[model samples]
Target: MNNRDEPANAVPRRAVLAGLAVLAGAAACSGGPVGPRRLRIASSAGDLGAGLADLVNRHLRDVEASVVTPMASAGTVDLIARGEAEIGLSQTDLLGVDASVTALARVYDDLLHLVVPADHPITTVDDLRGRRVSVGETGSGTAVTAGRLLAAAGLTAGAYVRSERSLDNATAALTRGDLDAFFFSGGLPVARIRELSARTRIRIVDLSGWAGALRSTYSDVYVVRNVPTSTYQAPPSATIADATLLLASASLPDALAYDVTRLLLERRDVLAVAHPALEALDVRSAAATMPAPLHPGAARYYRSVKP
Candidate 1:
């Protein structure tokens, strides 16, 4: 099921707009009661965007009288650049090219799962040397980080390594024996990975040993993560991997951005209910982010909560 097949009550543009309109009208009738602070939030389909929208809705339901509209296209960075939207729930890496955008918060971290055929003899990072690997789409965060990871292992991209665009396309090529591995970053319980794993014998490649190198090459904030054994259906398990996810764009109003940061810090438990990936957000970890700078509003909120 695509976006059209979502269950009722799922946040849609028209639906959220209608709600915001009503709130706006009420505020106008109330003679300028600070007005309904409506903010347009956008992101690609998956846990981070949807989960964050839901969290914002519930958290600000009464405080500022607001509504969150989730969009699939016109991604976060683009939204901020074009001003088509006010807030974006995407990665900073995608927005790195644009100076107008800044990160409001690091909603969750992503794990880059290096997936290879289960029967393949590539048991470790060292095995990926001189192999055909699909790094992900060009201009994508996945490929950018994939290059970094490969460099950390002393394998120079476009030389000892091969890269491609997507996992689906890569998976097809892998099945036909055209590619050795592929990479992606998302929340735990990734449906795409699970489906791919079921149809083919696949294993995640481990990078924990290269954690120090990964940090040294990139930023120290990113750490190697273990792809839990229970998460996938591989009989004996395959391998572990590391990845990261980030929030980007300088779209939201400084005031609204501040509120959003404050809301996440204060009501993260509410957010975690919708997506376990965000459960990691805490006062301490909330301020630690990289690649993109934090919104001024977010900085204010973080300063207030620094205790």
Candidate 2:
């Protein structure tokens, strides 16, 4: 079992609902009634998006106009453009890359922690020089955030610090003494980080000073935060880090997107249980979270929502 301890089935616990919606899409594509369409939401299984998939489905179940389909992790831009999934989690950095999809809501932030072996020679993002690093899977938000942050510090992918592997594999490599440092984005205290912490000494590199500069370069989309030492049982108590997380879709119907957004706002408690960070999700800050524009439909909701 991967140290995740989360079940494979647990990843898309909303499979039945999602499968039904997939069928609905196929039916619509095949020229069926396409009546009261079901909306499919693509989320990386076993990731933070997956954790919220169920919460989203539960709230969306009663909406007769549409259904929310949960999907495994794939390309966020592709899924939305192809109409395979109407809603999916997107890296905040993807705002200008495509004009097709739009931001329905602002999900919580994915933390970009620079991890290293406890005794390693690195203490900040700048110290990554002359060492091996993992910037996350290519085409991943991790790569975007890691690359930009490193660039802000005068480095480049595979140039300044060699990117070894994805966050999952990199964590394993780090434990085996193969990687010097790794940076990736995900909900705080993610399973991978927790697993690594249990077996090897690890730390969330502090990046408070450079955050402002990074924000300027990467779009104010990246928020600066401090992951408490308590987050991973590390040595320090407070440490600043970069943020990377957002939600979007190019295919989601404006009305349907509005409903899903409304659904989440109404059921704050359920989402809070999955990730405490969601406690801060709100309509007002939704657009500010994305580097680009918010979905026109979602923008409508945000404007009408007072306070």
lDDT (10s digit) by residue, model 2, range 21-78: 9998998899985444555656654454554455555656544332233332336657
Please give, for residues 1-307, the per-residue lDDT of candidate 1 as tens digits: 3377787667877778999999989988988756455556565544455555666666665333222333322255666667655666654334445677776666666677788888898877678778887887765656766767777776777554576656678778887888888887666656677777778777777756666776666555556565676677664332223323334446566777787778767777776665666677776666765666777888888888777
Q: What lDDT score is found at residue 179 in candidate 2?
A: 84
How much lDDT does each candidate structure score?
0.65, 0.66
**Clash numbers, per candidate:** 8, 1
* Best of the candidates, lDDT: 2
Each candidate's root-mean-square deviation in Å?
Answer: 14.2, 15.5
Which regions of candidate 1 deviate over 4 angstroms? 1-42, 45-47, 50-85, 89-102, 154-163, 172-178, 233-251, 262-275, 290-296, 299-307
On the 0 to 100 scale, the lDDT of residue 47 in model 1 is: 47
Question: Model 1 — which ten-residue stretch has the worst lDDT?
Answer: 65-74
